[model samples]
Target: MHKFHLSIAALAGASVIALAAPVQAQDTAAQAPDAANSDIIVTAQRKQEKVTEVPISITVANQAQLERQQVNTMNDLNRIAPSLEIQQAPGQNTGGGGSIRGIGTQTFSAGAVASVGVVVDQVSQGNANISDLFDVSRIEVLKGPQGTLFGLTTSAGVINITTNAPDFHAFSARVRGELSDAGTAGSKFGNQVLQGVVNLPLASNAAIRVSGVANMRQGVNRNLTTGDLNDNDRYGVRARLLWEPADKLTVNLIGDYARARAENGGDFFTFIKTSTGVGSEIANCGLVAREGNQNYCTSQSYVGHTENYGGSLQIDYQAEPFTLTSITALRRSTETGYSAASNVFRADPLALQVANGPVNRHLSLFTQEFRISSPSDQFFEYTAGAFYSRQKQTRDPETLSVMLTLFPGMTIPLVDPATTGAGANDKIVDESLAFFGQGTFHLSPGLRLIAGGRYTTDRLSLDRYNYATAVASNTVLNVGNFSWKLGAQYDLARNAMVYATASRGFKGGQIATPSAPAVPFVVLPEIPTAYEAGLKTTLFGGWVADLSLFYQKIKDFQAQQCTVDSNSVISCVQRNIDGVKSRGAEINFFGKVFDGLSLNTGFIYAKATYPTGFVGTDGTVIGGTQLAYAPKYKFTLSGEYEVPVTSRFNGFLAVDTVWKSRIRYEANSRSETTFRPHWLVGGRIGVRTEDDRYSLSVFGRNLFNVHEPSLIQSDFPFGGAANIGAIYGPQSFRQVGLSFDAKF
Candidate 1:
């Protein structure tokens, strides 16, 4: 399947390039009607310009494109971006992890941080907890390493989201709703959302704008044994206000609050059967059932709630030669969960030992940045900035489990043991500060030079206290790095530029877990450097294309593990691998073939391999092998067309498809049953008023009903010489829905 997908992608690329040949020649003939042309302006480079002008690898999904494609979240955007992937946690559905450029953390450990960074309205949402989206303008995805401009968290590039700001124009409002079904047995869901934006002209010199969103979704799936809802229920609300008192300076203050209640059945791999004499699947083994008198599977559940709030203030001043901007943002989140214990499978006969637990996490983040930029029209332009961020996180998790025994002809009552249960508490504080600058110098009429550098310092302090084992630990680490970038761009024509760059990225150091009940490990972080060359071009006058080839080397990559002491208390640990290398090439193109017709396509080919041998849990060497979840190929294709239906109405149609090559999800030396390949195709059809004030859209996603496992793990719980294989998340299948939007 992996080979087949790659072949298809290669063929498609060849076909599209062939089709572009004549289109490029006809560009001059179709150059008229500039206003009605389907050209887009983007701010991906921090300045508004034609998409074809930037000499970087980027993909833009504008507001109209998002709405037409029914994209409401980052997960939805993943379908059209080949190098990106998202996955939910083990026991809870509310939180998840994301990866880009084949670098991400897949563990459920509380201390783990994401490799990818998310930005909203220029404020950093770097943590894994800030994944929600609401009231957004557009999303800009920059592929490859983005260290120079995006800082430490963006080792795998950046996802910059610009939210819809307060409209200075009169009152505007919008409302939308959707209903969906999982297609699996006992699954159904629905969502309702209301949003509005209003602008008030206070006197002649001031204006105020307010925007708010309210959303709720019903849960689906009920636990067969507990007769309780298994997966469902989500809702949140956000509001922001903007105040502008002067023409040259503007102050924007924003605050939002969100809360949700949901249940989780962690990674529902097929259920286990109880005894051979069992009457039914539910009556087999309490929560663990025997499949064929030998194999068994355990069931787990979780109920969680999360609340978040944040506010930011921005001040901008515009001058003749330079502009100064200052932004300050602060945010906090609280999360709590109650879950049933996991890993209850046994080959021998035993009654289920029930374990119920709760975990809580509190997080706070603060950031301040000041920037000064030169005017855009000069022969030499520059941007210099100072950035700072501080984060604090506290976590407490408790679990209680009891052992149970039963006889064939006797009834066993479930009882809690007198053994003292164990609990763990952790507090983490991290701070980062950087001084960065970027400059563009015109060397000649057609050649330009660009260079950027950032000096960054990261400090972390961690304290852990275990109540069950009566052990406590504290660690502190500080690291510094100077990352720089140099690039040269040569314009081949009026709207084409070819550039090459050398850049570097770093991930911070962290405390590690001990193996074999010995000394604790404190591993240093990883540093990845990339050498890339790319071409940015405009063809057919309406088409924008970008292609890049990159090679990256990472030293000391961080990974996860766990260790137990003599007292049977477990401690989650982090470790560092010696070295790894990744090399890849990406191609992306978007164009308007004719009036009201547009198409977009992208492809990525990557390979990640370790040079030296690394030891696995069983002390086997894994060398010259591929890393986990790093596929060889991934591609995306989407097209949309708009047609006039009448004098007052228009019709729209679109098709989107994604294909992913097979990936190994486990350590290369340990297991082999970890690859999965899948493809998804979807479409949308809608009708809208000519003025774009009102519209109706009906869409179906994952229409092909491809069920592809997003994650796989082997040797998960190496207890007593048994290996467990766990898989999570396949595409949810076809979902059909209708939406309505209007401006009032």
Candidate 2:
């Protein structure tokens, strides 16, 4: 609480200083020649607009910014965007999840759906994976519900990624490579990346573009028994074709494929307890090991791999007053892996080891959309669209094993056997259809009224079979809902605006895999109503600042719950909390403080809590507790300076830092699952050709070498032990690297 107050006070002071400074009576259109701090263009409203002119809270990162920040994957985005939080899924490294403003999904089951949606090239992704960042044009992060414009309805927000399109008038090629080493004892060349892109003009009206990336990195964690574990080797390729057969018509086709082969990072046990008889045996296991130790052990090699491929076709036609667009897309992905319950192994007194059965999953998705929009220059502008999507997923049967050193000679059968295999094969299918429309009415030259709405219907079905018991079950759900948004914006002056908005968002309900015959198999949907007010301004003709305050009320919040049986086997279920409330404030600024220098800063303060009737798997009341992975306060500061060393060369330096308050890993809020506050610092220095055809640079990440755990989980007691055990996710290590780029 003290930290939160301090952060707020600091922001208030900065705001006061910024407002009190002498104002320059200059037009924003004729600002100083600071190309590095120019106005950012965004498409948050499904149309092109200046960031400062948009009513909602948003962040934009262009290709230059992404390269400077070294944001290659989803996890790396948090360094620049503090409100976005990401974590690796339990027992897996190749797949993970993210949340915006405390709304997200933590379960990896086929029945679960993510509250946050990820969109690439107008197509929604079924699952979150390591995204390849080669040949990307821009990334836009929307901070509120976007149900009315996007095909997928997510309660949280959306991440919109737009890749570079082919250019018909030019032929060009580029190559970039990087080499990095983990700054830790016994660490090797940990990260090596190579990427290339080429564009060829087939004719005056047609062009093709191709891009590929190769990435290899050594895992920071090690296994004493199996040398180097959790290493990464991945490759991806993308191709795009653009054709303009007529002056008023355009078409684009895109295809991409990616594959990864790697091992998941070993888990670190933060806490362990056993029966009193094995006191010395438990004392020998250490809590932390940089390389590997007996405490973190794996008898069999753990491996994970994934293959993903997708394609999309888009068409657009320009009319005198309106534009028509159509998009069709299909994607498929497959993943397989093995994970151990405990990374540590012991042979003495109470030797205990457990491993998860093989995991296999296959998923496919298809979507289509059609839209029409009026020109923005009109007094009344509007857009209307219809969207359809279908998805199917399958999970194969899996098994689990538990062994104890004390009972090595004893062979138990049935319930207490060394291995238990689940014969259940699960399948899930989902289909959705929606129609949405939005319009803006200009009351005056500087004031506008905006209204939008969406009508959606969804059908979900699940099938499960248990091989051991020969029990089969099927469930189906049909849901329909309406979401709407209303807002008004007024320009206080030509360079400043203030807006207010009220909106409603919805997520479809889900079915739970029955742990037993008596438990319920369905959970209700979630709905959140939000109200917000914001200010966007261009100050001093060279600085841009945006501030927003929002409040939300959620009913029937869906959350994941788990049960532990007498044999210590865990089963998952989804439940609905009665009520939850979230409120927050955000402030952002980007501008040139002086010639040849630029600065970007942001701050977020959020409080997300369950208001009533929230219970945990352990039968503990969790009312008034914070949501999982939601921190109270977050801040980021970054700056860069560039100077012309000569007419043909330029030198630059950049640095950034981020701070986050304490956060709980789960809704239960157990002491062992809490993560303390941490800070990270990173920087870069480089020299490049003035024309930007070639460059060389050096960069360092996690400069302070902070070892903060990204995730933690508590396990039920095994072997009749009174105390429970806990597992910790791998922490990112500090690294330094050099990179070079060439263009032709």
The TM-scores, one per candidate, come to: 0.83, 0.87
Instruction: Supply the TM-score for candidate 1.
Output: 0.83
Residue lDDT tens for model 2, 35-154:
334566777777777778888887666666677777776667676666677765453332236677776666645666666677888787755353567777777778777888887746
Regions of model 1 farther than 4 Å from truth:
1-39, 90-96, 181-222, 226-231, 264-302, 339-356, 400-421, 513-520, 561-573, 615-622, 669-673, 715-730
Q: How accurate is candidate 2 locally (lDDT)?
A: 0.69
RMSD of 1: 9.5
Which portions of model 2 show Cα errors greater than 4 Å?
1-37, 90-96, 128-130, 183-189, 264-295, 337-350, 411-420, 514-520, 540-542, 562-565, 591-595, 616-620, 716-731
Summarize candidate 1's per-residue lDDT along 1-744 as a digit string, tens digits.
Answer: 232234335434534543453321111112222224556566655555566666567887665566556665555767657777666544322123556667665554444455667777777764535545655666778765566666437776777777666544343344444334333222233334444444444545444545554444332233444544344334455555666676777777676666656555333332322223332433444443322111233345456676777878887788656888888988888878753233322212334344435768788889898888888778898788988988888877455554445655554433222224555567878889999888889888888888988888988877877655567888788888888878888989887788888887776666542322233345676777878888888767777788888888887776554332233233345666767777888888876656688777889987777567676544667776667667778898888889999999999998888888877655545443344567777777889888666677777767665545544333222231233333333244355666566544
Task: Tell me how many residue pairs clash in candidate 2.
Answer: 3
Model 1: how far residue 107 lies from native, Å: 3.6
Scanning candidate 2 in windows of ten residues, the lowest lDDT window is 24-33
Residue-pair clashes per candidate: 4, 3
Q: List the residue pairs that clash in candidate 2.
A: 295-344, 297-343, 423-467
The 10 consecutive residues of candidate 1 with the worst lDDT sum are: 23-32
Global local distance difference test of model 1: 0.60
